[model samples]
Target: MESRPKVTPLTRPSARRSHVPPLGVHPTPDGGIDVAVAASHADGVELCLVDVVEPHRDAHDPARYAERRFPLDGPVYGVWHGHVPHVRPGQRYGFRVHGAWDPEAGQRHNPAKLLVDPYARGLVGDLTYGPETLGAVSAPRRPDEPDSPDGRWWVAERYGAPDDRDSLAHVPHSVVVASHPGPPPLSRPRVPWADTVVYEAHVKGLTATHPDVPPELRGTYAGVAHPAMIEHLTSLGVTTLELLPIHAFADEPRLVAHGLTNYWGYQTLGFFAPHAAYATRSARGAGPAAVLDEVRGMVHLLHEAGIEVLLDVVYNHTCEGGDDALHVSWRGLDNAGYYLHDGASPAALADVTGTGNSLDFRRPRVVQLALDSLRYWAEVVGVDGFRFDLAVTLGRTQHGFSPDHPFLVALQTDPVLNNLKLVAEPWDVGPGGWQTGNFPPPTAEWNDRFRDAVRGFWLDAPREGSHGRPMHGLRELTTRLAGSADLFGHSDPPLVRGPVASVNYVTAHDGFTLADLVAYDHKHNEANGEDNRDGSDHNLSWNHGVEGHAPRGAEGGDTATEPWSAVVPLRRRSQRNLLAMLLLSAGTPMLTAGDELGRSQGGNNNAYAQDNEISWIDWDLEDAARDLLDTTRFLLALRREHPALRADSFFLGTPRPGEDEPDLLWFDADGAPMDREAWDMAGRRVVQMLRPGPDDGDAHVLLALNGGLDDVGITLPPAAGGGSWERVWSSSWDRPEAPDDEADDVTLESLSVEVFLNR
Candidate 1:
């Protein structure tokens, strides 16, 4: 192995008097700013002051602003000097630190590189990506290559030229505040955990081109809080709006090179600051409080409408990236201490997040930062809960991912966050990753099994013939519908059963939309600038007949205007099937944005890089799409009508009254008991399931699935006591009401699911 570069600790002389700029004012004691940067790092640091009086001050404004250099002393981090004059909110500022530049040893620092404050409350300007921002540094030369790396630094560069590519600088500390002032009083409707329905959406993509939302409000925080958006969410009967990451994030340098930006704000730079771009008004003109006030107002408005707010947080890694990355707060403060460094070298980071470095939860300060951020958002920001991104990373100690990790324990025991809904992404790109059921009882995780199994039984399995026949046994589907006890056992209480422990979903922001899943057999990500090598290969998708937007060559290239052929019916049926399975399942269900109205990614499975039409949800839906929306509303009503489907506890896999068999049973096409040999058969494509009656002994439900290519006869099981089975709902059928008694034994069509009730 090659030897690593030399490492050295840089130190600066202490000053007798404080020269740091004054910290901004705090409206409330709890909302005051903490100078964490001063206390954390011991390098040459200085705070740049931008004048608030000069409204249109530029970066080169010498008279209006000044830079004060400061040095750290033992114990006393720095002085605040209270709220100084001419230094209110909406001030643009940054930090200049003179540090070492040794990428081989994992420390790349240049005083010339203007850096953003890691804890800035708000941002002022947009980042300009290119080579001029790269700073006066050179890559180390390889022994085999004779060229000196020094010539690259002094080369003159043009704005759009290839050599000027490194000039693109990321505005790391540009934080955006709510446009209005003060946190809105908590007035949202309170729905119990068992009855909660979560609707996950992206603020920008959800209404970027929405027709109903006002043009000014579209694609902004104000737009999402508009009456149109609220009415839509309310109509769907969603109790909580689980938003994707909204914190101020940095657009990757490479994405900018490809003329794209980070659609999902996962690369966080400011934990306390909201992304200003999502605000309808400009942060510079409206003031920092404008952004802050608008966000709080949105939360309050949603609350008033009986909805909860759950923010998706990303704390696994900072936007600063790798060793050669920028020296933002965490890296400058104490790189080795704040990040997970190699055990052997101590100064080298152990890149676990695949985004460069993973935060060191083992450190007391690092753990405190995370806990404090969470509490700040929940209490100060007035959010209902948090969905942690790569949560397993925060739970890892020296041993492994532990439920007793300090961060987990703190959240479970924290007074402020304990009552709030706590959710976890459950896994990171690290060793011992993919911890689905391993989260503490207090936190609910996104159930990947639910996503895969449901997709497998309905679409993936039948097309590929992977999991012993394309369609699974009714016994297996019943277990999933009633909550998977096999995955989450009885180790926890009924209130914390596997069902409540999981957040069920068929599609999410990371993969294909519900529509695209039923329209594309393979991923089409050639537009991602990676030659289709960027997205996941195991999509588990199936194209009904065509691949991209056009029909396949095998179908004689028919371009008819059929409902299913045009992506409308397929989207509706797939969404209805997925939603019915999700809401009717025992776990809490989450609905993706626009899935209720048949949104499509144009058959693009992975759209992480496509910030344009490929990722944005088309708010304008056709009549068929409107019908799909109605179907979603109807399904939500059905879910709300029955408590059995959303039980906090898992139902025992045993026989029940009002049903001929157990709470769950596997049956063949003839409605006969399925044997082990039959269950293992790879060609089996049909199964029937029976859900036990509610605890109060109300009605029983029988679900049937057929993944075969042709219609098949399905014999009805003998009804319990003296009742007869009635067809209540079918994916192939249009109406909500069941068919007449004349169809006792129904013929199920290919790629169809039906629900029957015993009356």
Candidate 2:
């Protein structure tokens, strides 16, 4: 491992003592802008003030712009500081880092390249990707291709190239945004982990095609906080809106080439800036400062309605792909210092994130950059929390992943970040990357095991497709439904992360939606441009007798083009089963954007590249979709009304100290407690979970699930809640309407789940 200095907070030098107190474009007392950038090993760095020739540009064309450069004062504590008196808000600016062009020594600096300030709060214009934009220095390329240098192509053995080609014309300019207007309002409805119901939605998709959101404001940040959107969130009992990445990001060059964009916004550029594309056209015209104001305005509105906003942040890698040839942004500034490199050779990247390059958290400078960006968003943007995408990369050390890594410790102890809802997508592609249950206490991690287990039980039990094998045994399901104590319940150091540590969900943005899980057995990812080989094939899904949507007629027939009306019951019931398990289970539940309404991506499991109708939510729901929405509302309501469903602590399964009945009672098909053999056996698909409310409370919840293909009668044990059973909900019911009374013994329909409440 390359040796580097560690920066403990106590030992770190103060920025104010050296002169510039803050990085990025901060307003001065005298109306100038103080711009600071961190380039640790750069020989020289210049702040460039650019003038725009036009607000728009053509594709594969040089941006109409020019630049005047000013040398930064010093490399003080790795930060280059300067004050530009002429530059103000909306003023286009960027940095030109100068140093060695050697790649083996971990330096790819070319003054011809325009680098983005890592702390840019507002990025103006989008990066136009071409040879000039990607790199000014010629990189070794294909033997057959011509080289484009100085805006002209040369094909003389493809060897002629311009060394002095300035890439400023195609590079994005970082805008000097003035400080935010006053302070963001301090009122936040910080939802507790137990009661928090996270609705994971992309900011644009949530409102883009909504009927109620105004036409002009349909896909903007303002639309997300609009009254129409807020009303839906409130009505659905959503406590937190976990938005997909809204940071300034660039679509992958491949996706752009295919005329598709990164809809999920996973690839990040400026971590501090809100994506300008998602802002209103007026906001973009008003300039970069208004873009941030609109984001804060969204937060303020959601906070007022007692809802929290959690951002899905990507800190693991930059949009600068792994190619050492690209001299833009981070790669241009300090390639060696910013990103992790293979120890054997610095030219090759050690990318654990599978995103081309992994940011080196081992370096304190990069750590400071992330910490600063987070503080900016939480304190300045006024957002509630952050869900770190591929968070395992952040906590990975030189040896492997560590729970007590410097960055993890800093987050747990840092005052600003400690109060926020820190979530981790805890796994990467590197060695020992599966750290799902390994994150420290007081934070949650997305539980893929929970996802797989649930999907296997409901969808994979009956079929042995090329997709995968049969269902996982009852033991796995029981463990996941009860908060996966075997995983997250760490007794070491006496820190037992409770049920809330698991962020339980069966579907997310990267995979098939809940609707697709019921409607398709195979992925239809032809729209993603990679043919059908792009998305995951191991989708534990069962198409209800037909692929895609089949009309609601021909109930008694079985043919190739059969309407498959009989298939509808099992599909609907299965959908209900997934949602009920997600909401009622002992963990923090995350519902995807359109999953509540049975939204289908036409079986495209991975829709990361699809930005059009296939990805944008269709809010105008049909009859069946509307029914799923109502079911979602009711499920959320049940979870809210009963504290037992959202348990703060994990159930021990054994009887409590003075009570004969355990908090949770698990049983098999015959209403008998599950024994060792039953827990390990397959084909025994019937299970009942009985949960008692708070101590001495009269209400309780009983959930019965039968995965069999035939209706089975099961006897209900004596009521633990001390009242007759009211059939609160059933997956098989056509309407799923008002609750009906049921006898002690009830017949569960094939492929169904039933809920009963003792009141």
Candidate 3:
């Protein structure tokens, strides 16, 4: 008979417990690990030590692995704690809390559902979406039961009973990770807000189809850190690289049923754990520890290239979803405490986000969870900052969205978080959720108003003629083009929230690409399995008479047809106009990943589910794409070199003591100063904006924009301080090559933009 290895017994590390144990499992100085979890309503919490199963045996089968459960000591301020000797790093574990199954009171405790640690630093395995992971038995609504407002009556059925199926197999195992020594501390590239140019991209989509990236490293953390990828970012002159959600996430069952995955990764499973799928295959083969190191490597490489990494985090919701969804973590541990529920119906979830459930930021523990996760990513993971998704939900309290909400206040007060970049999406689907420009100081917001105004002035207004009405005036466009003082400025204190607070962008990941905004008026999201009914219909776009792709050669084809040959050039010019407005504006600008290269999703505004080529950026450079990239580079260089465009404070309009003209002056096509009526005139589509240099010694900048159907003559105003004007960039050019110096009179093309500098 084969001799079996001797089994060792776990020893007790200590009996004394502190006032409050730190949450999550931490390796002790002794050989053991100390585990603590917050489960307020649980009667007893058991720590389950799991043994790795054999490769040949079904690794996903819970019954295949041996698990030993130990009761922990706690309920001291709602925290459960314990210390087990012999548990080392890389050990897989989970929690099972025993409590009353009273759904009406929001105390959902099912010991059979193994729960993931909310503070787990690393996780292994993928969450299998099935009956095993669902904490409650999902039943069909009875004929006698009344329907809910959401129209899904079966969602209420989750409160009926506890599911007894063991969830150890289907759920991801939380692994104990010890702090490993890494390369010397990264020197962060803390680019100031004024000089910050955010380039929002996806870890996978950005490099998946990159031609130069090694095939094995493509679409992985290592891929982003690859030299080829870093070169692109550096060459583009973007100061910050904002990546989409990298938190460990799971695909919703509905998406999985339709043979699709959550490509956007908004559904977060483990905040602390790096999304394992994003790691290179080599790192993944080495386990969770290696996966985390890959993420750090990416950040380190980016920082080395003088680029900051900002994660688009989803703290408002979890992958567990709503009442009828799976319950792998928070819900199973303490449902009443972790999630927000309706005041009248305690069992029903309060979903401010379009997602099924929203985390209750009102609760202290929930707030603690989010803060802890953020600290881990910032300090341990080495990311420079975060862009919080659905940030308005985080600021929502019992009363409503408050600037002083506990979570928001805590972030401002926290020593680690306050110094880091904090960006808020600034809206949710909840009541009174539009809280733009209401966030605290030092926090920048995604400026949707700037996006709308720029799109309307360039793409919409000309397509839909403005018939001499005050409604289509330059007031709205100018407000956004300037610092948007009407929205971000405080008259009481003057420039309290400066132009830095507005993150201007014409296109984001959620909307149409820069090319699509000019090529398709309607969204073509037929592949999302929603029958093209999903995605926003309020896209303020103009197709320039073409519905889909322009005739051959317009978008890199062999030859071009009649109107399309003309329309395509106009579309490309419109794109340039939009890009120029965003970069030249006196606010921090954000550029979408493939917008510079003119990448399009074939009119699919929302490609959150199409994980294939539809979302991945194609690296094949066409003539138009190459020109757009060069134009982007030129604009970025202009913004970087000129302090006028990157204003630290709002323009005072009045000239400084040493200046010859007002700090900013607006002129009409006739070269005369614009009056009140001219500012509101609808048919008046041409405007010349002049901004003085930082000092009398520097060159003053001039921007002349013509947003009409017919070309107009613009008599350039005399330089702000009186030097000759030289035309630098123009949308009329096929390439970004500097245009010849022009005199007083220049013909501005229809729907085109021009930039000039006075030296």
Candidate 4:
């Protein structure tokens, strides 16, 4: 990367203290049409009015348009006044500034760059990309050439391009002008954390290729709220649809080069604005209100289904990168104040996001901006909650990451956000990045441990010579299944308790889909165009037989045929076992999109840049996939039916009222108590868990799992309160079978799980 230009307070012009002009169509103090552009660094600013129908060669055609130059007494801080006869909404204009371009000392302010309005609510044309767009300077003569003396001049050319004639003709110039229309009136569903089951999904990928969704509505907000989509989510018993970021984001320059996009939508350009691409109606002709209405409609429909809407928000940084960055909103408004700069140097940015810059949460105004944006989404968009991406960056102050940082404190105390479900990714690529369990009370975090543990148990442990020991034994797995109290038990009030505090998952957007987890061991990222150098190395995954592509039914190999074929039967069983473990756990269980239907990324663990079929959910599934979905549905229903499994209090290894047995009990293959030796034995595979009855006092559950290669005999402990054991559901069994009401013991198949009720 090229070294960023240094910006010093003393060397730069007094324009550093300029203010941002207000946005939107509003009457002036005199009740006349008022238009202004906020250009803080301009010595002399001119608003050029170009004829929409004229060609570039006809610049001298006075018959079509005109230009007005406004000399500034100082840098135009807020608004540069242009009265009725000159400017108004729908007027197309561009800015020309007069400043310095001294590259040696880091002051590159070419008046010819033609800056976009920082407060522009809409964009009329696509940014042209090519060497000619780099201004008057020539392209680097050679590939490895460094920034030449005229590099700044070359950079200026790429700054501005003529708007697309057709795209611009249809788009009104005034549409780009910001308007401070007060918050939209929105009806919100107030659901508590205990009753909420969040379903995390991608806005575009979720319905983009769904056959049931209309072609026009595919990958848009309308698709998300389509009757079919709503009905499906409602049928799944989802209480909250936690959408990945829908904010306007820029495709990374590299990913774009490879014909891929930032499908995950993590790179945000505007916090308060929605991504125009996700809108069914064009933002250009229909305007921001149209987009807002569609988004609100989606929220309304979800609310009508009694499901809440939550947004995964990225506030760690702005899309405008380093010194070579665009003068977009925050970077233009106040780069030094809005972004975290090296405290010692005070000129270079401290990039914690690895996206070129990190927002400075220490700055009060920046903190206010984040808080204001959160409020805007929650109030204006009618969102029920927010999942902060790389949230550790938001809570960091000058001293380091603080639990009581002003931004966090403000969120915790703010009346509007107080009751909202606040979740955090919890860490960033900064010093002390692994702060998984360090968040303050009431903030649920993505439990990476749970993901690893479950993956280890069902996939990694089954494959021999996989380096790590198999997690087939009960103790460690049981702790994760019970919410990992060891990691979250330190809070004074114990905020991260029960089902509301932990977002348990086996897969997420950043990793392989559940199917791929059981199909591949190493990341195959050659498609990322980095010579397979990109993506993480620590997959902790295993392919049962063959490695990547293998012949069908090839004996002794881990290929999809032999060992991989065996995986087919084991995959569904393991999936159900994992799903049962997640739903029955004491934390909030999050289901990754398409995990229910067995979506596979073709063993490509990292599909960040694969936006094609490899990343899109097939939706079409085989019989096994259907079976997995049905099993998940049944497990979800079981969780809904039992409050004891989802209790608000942490299990203390003690019995409940009217039950002589502890709330949870561990048993070995022979139905005997699991002693220390048995718990430590690496050969142990059969384990059983018993949960006490709920408030009804008539329900109790016995969950048994046999990971061995053959059937294992299990003796049932004496029934609590003189009741007999009855099997309610089993992964190995096709239908729900009543347990042997008279028997004290039963045998379970290899790699199977069974859930029983006491009568």
Candidate 5:
């Protein structure tokens, strides 16, 4: 009954405000840090501060730092925030979000476990995963469940309780930084998507072994921006450097347990933070600020060299994993809102991604988080664009995948984002997940159909017989070579996506390299420790006259004890043919990194987990490798010179009224017109594509294909000017000392591709 001060309840409700303003660590005039984070279902939120740990240690040592917590005020629009006094750009911090612990309902919030700030722009160190730090508890496989590929997934349940596990010593804390994070070298290159050649390279792998890169700078951001690397990219005629994910990511705990690492950097932890591991050791010694400068400086130098930087972003999933996984950020802050959950049990995640969890696109705040992250990278970090990994998951709804999803629409219309180049992987492993060529205008999607079709013609032949499928037809190959109009342009309103929508490539980062495509017919993934069953078996590759590397054969082609050289001719010619098919096609072409230099992974198709020599590019180029490099540069230059080769629109097949000749003319092996009957031939293996000269250019291009086992005569179609055809380039270039055999019949050898210029 005496005067006792009223005690405040722990739960505080946040309301949607009229003018909510921005979130995350914004700098204030008084030199304090304004911290904000979005957590709708949280009962409370606190910004925790820790003493800056210098010379960062990896162990879970408690005596490393001091800790203090400050409760945030009213969460405007479900965003809890507060301005911390005496805080500057270098202050170290983390979040302790206090909420419910009901995993069954998909709300696994525990303040005892420290969480990462979702909007953290700079990360300090690597995530130290353990039983308590990772939170992924396991049990014996259940009898009722079927076996999984990894066996550990079939009966696994990510559900776990918030143990009173204090992860302060093990968990990495986010760093406070200046409100304006970067001054990217220049504005977005805004390269025309049609003219763009995406060179997909890993930050570390691209420069890790380059000889000219300073020993200390090798594998660092500086290495990628070094003059040596820049010269190679520029000489290759690549307009954009599409780097593999450099976002702050972690090696999957299971990958670590298997004695491997995530070399691809797909297991992202923080969307706004660059992977600090890729920075030079000197930069790490300096501080996080130096790391930021190094990354920004790389981008700046790239822009100066007339190149754009696009990030391969993995926003579909995070390193937080699922119910049994770690509570690094979103899972601990507001699990139910951040992820899609099973409607019936709620606790079980609706993981469309192979990863344990998929980001929920239905929630507005969740969409905002992704948008904010994209803006941070595009505007603050100065990246030209993004290639969204598992992009179908980003457009999914409760009803299934929707091209008209809110997130997709927002991406197309956002003032700042619409101008940026956006590419989608276009598929996931879930139901109705293959949405290739379905995404709307301006956003290009990876044309896997094109990839398979090219591979089908060049590598997978009917009689090759190494687990390869039969070739569809010469017409099928033409359809892909002409930008796969049947797939991307066959829409109700005519062509939904033009020729530019298809990113044509025979090889990508996910599958075999140009060299390995012809070197090994089967995958050898024993180093992954998964029993060689981790990668796809549909390689469509041929061993060309030997497996792995055999002894040289006698003059007639029989090997006794020496390594065989019989397969070498077909191998080199095949590499040139594949390269020609990619660049000469009428679509945006993407060249995988090191493919020009004939890079190989020792027949390993899936090297995602190999962080060593297996994944790093071998800079020491062999003779064949140098030839392939020169051939690649020649093809790229040809593509740039011939406007007819890079058509802006799909060919109508029939002649246009005003044109002197048809936009594109198709022919069979005997020079006859490709009628319906000829195109329908299942065994057909020869084709001739005649592209007339553009209005301004004089070069009329002819692309001929001979997939037959023996040489057959090819007749040139009559040209508009009635001029003879001249052989400009051939896939079967000088193999050692063998000149292309010229003949009156104009016969071509088996599996050969040739290009001609009609005067």
Candidate 6:
């Protein structure tokens, strides 16, 4: 059991005193490679060397390589280590751990299953969800059961006897890469939390259909760094580009069977390896190292443009899925130590992430794995921050989620991770999972409250007795505009996490685009092959006068030839209103990609599986699309210039040093300050918010909104120093080309937003 020898092996006097190698395949100074793995319950571990038969063969070809197994030496502190002579870069490998197959004790080790190293820096090929990849056999189908069209007969009996069929041909191989996997490290943009305007985008969907991007680079990492994309982001005032998962992932078997794919990239396979599919054709052909360089190059270019890069990392669960899923990695390597269990004889996995399995953060090794991965991305790959998907699950313990959990504490105290931006999705499917404001300081959260409040104020139609008003009143709207102080403002330790802790967003990747939000009252997810019952029904949306204005090749099956409805103007106004609130509020704002272009999925709220035209951003903009883009750019630029809009701290309603006017003042339509009666009125549709600029020399800003269907004359409140109000922008106009108007009494159009500055 040895590798094809070129150099002689080095030996120590005693194996007990020999030093253990670090985990994963690391090339040593000597002409050999050191391999280490933690297989606590395994009887033996064998390192398999793979020789590629054809370099450019199909990624999933079963006979793509020939493998030779060599036994490794260890069990020291439950870790296995070995050195193979003459191993060099680009060598493909995997591991086989031999141990007891007693699922009752949660030891699911199967030598028959070849496992990818969890710490592999480079991985090639994709996983096939065939019988070879499963740890256990499918249960016997009853006479009444229906046949599986995909040959996935029935649910797997995970506790039954192990399936001895070899899985070497079904899964990917871990490649031994050079120590420096990516390009030379570049300085990170390191954008401040308060000043960051995050633009959430999918690497492929962002520029897949862009007319300006070259055909060779489209739908790849190189496409993201294209000058056209860079110019768009920079001109739009985006300070950060938050990418969806770039980690290697696998499409769920169900999605494969349905003839669809997981376009969201949430199902992670290898955390260390970049998804090769995202690289250009030349890079993929060049091998795994080239793919890494392409990813690094994108980050480098984005950083050069003064934009930060944040990764949406999914560490809550692996792509291996649940009890009835594949055994490609952790499940086969160390099932008991890696995953949470329900305390049964044959322990059932405790799944908090909807993806089927939840990793146990209680284990030190598991926490180490997460911490190591974070450091690698931050230091090696040069990313600015991370947004944890299903973050609540990472902080969960036996008693439930705790802010003081070891993993969370470690992140806050770690030297390499503490300074980076840490954002939490802040919820899971588990009990007490909605811990929105419970995370510790410095950890920002996605504010669903902001999304709902803004959407309700602008999109929901008037209810009975509400006098043509939207569902929410002045109080709700004002609260969100002021940064939802009740949620983020804490008194236990005054301003522990200020208004900046809230990431305000009206629409995100999971739901409808901003355009669809104003045009569809219900979700059209029938394209997902789950009937119409797959997505959320409580959309809190209003279709206005028409059911939909389907874009070209929309997934909802609507025709593009349908005439525009009369309510089109109103829908555009509502989009402007939502965007204004999101950008002008006293919190960090996150804009979804393509919202600026008024992109639509034809009312398909859940387009996660629609990887084609429905999900890819259509860059061929019409007149209306161009107008919306201009509006977004104008709003973003205004927010950047005005410090009052993106206030770092919450307003206290009291006067600041040497200022007579309060830091923030509320006014009624009559130019008088709002009283208790006005604040509590449900029929009130118009409200004014006045905020002082950063300094006395700067102009004070006032935001006025009319949520009613008719015109409302708003009497301008005198500035602290007494000056006329200059109307700089209005949502009534289709674009921001309207001239600035100076007036004391400004009439606001129906469902419109207007901003004023006192000169």
- Whose lDDT is greatest here? 3
CA lDDT of 568 in candidate 2? 67
Expressed as tens digits, the lDDT of each residue in 451-529 for candidate 1 is 8878877777566543344445445565677677666663545335557778888888888888778778888887776
The window of 10 residues in a row where model 4 has the poorest summed lDDT is 163-172
Note each model's CA RMSD in angstroms: 7.1, 6.1, 4.4, 6.8, 4.5, 4.0
Give lDDT tens digits, candidate 5, residues 1-759. Answer: 322212234557546464444777776889887778888888888788878454374446665666788888757777887777788887778887777777788777777667878788787855665655643343433222232233232112455555665777777778887766556445656777667888999999998889999989999899999999999999989999999999888877666655568999888888888889999998887766778778888988998988999999998988877677677888888888888887867468888998889998988887888899999887777888889999999998989888889999999899878888899999998899898888876688899888877787777773363345455546667888888887788555878568988988888888888888987889998888777878889988877757674422431234334334456777778888889999999999999999999888888999999888988999998666787888888888878877778787788877777765678888887778898898878878888888876674568888889876667788877655656677767888843223444322467777888887765
Candidate 5 to truth, TM: 0.92
lDDT of 3 by residue, 112-208 (tens): 8888999888888877766777777864332221321221222325667888778787888999988655444877899999999999999899999
User: Number of clashes in model 1?
Assistant: 29
Deviation from native of the Cα of residue 79 in model 4, angstroms: 11
Give the Å shift of residue 532 in candidate 2: 1.9
TM-score per candidate = 0.83, 0.91, 0.94, 0.82, 0.92, 0.93
Better of 4 and 6 by TM-score: 6
Q: Candidate 3: deviation at residue 660, Å?
A: 4.9
On TM-score, who's better, 4 or 5? 5
| lDDT ranking, best first | 3, 6, 2, 5, 1, 4
> What digit string (tens of lDDT, one per residue) describes model 6 on residues 1-759?
322323223232133736787788899999789999878777788888888777576655545667777787867776788899999989989988888788888889888888999889889877776678889886533222142244332346877778877777789889998888543556677887778899999999999999999999999999999999999999999999999999999888777766678999998888899999999999998889899899888989999999999999998999988878789989988898888888877578888887789999888778888988898888878888999999998998889999999989988899988999989999999989898878887789999888888887787744222344344555777898897788888646877687889999999998999999988878888787777667777776777756787444431223233344355766787888889999888889999999999988878888888899998999998777888999999999888888787788878899777867678999999899998988888768888999888785777889998887778988988866667788988988888876845888889887888999875
**What is the Cα root-mean-square deviation between model 1 and the actual structure?**
7.1
- lDDT (Cα) of model 2: 0.80
Task: Kindly list the per-residue Cα lDDT of model 4 for residues 73-124, writing each as its tens digit.
Answer: 2344434534444344444544444444332222334433444443334433
Q: How does each model score on lDDT?
A: 0.67, 0.80, 0.85, 0.65, 0.79, 0.83
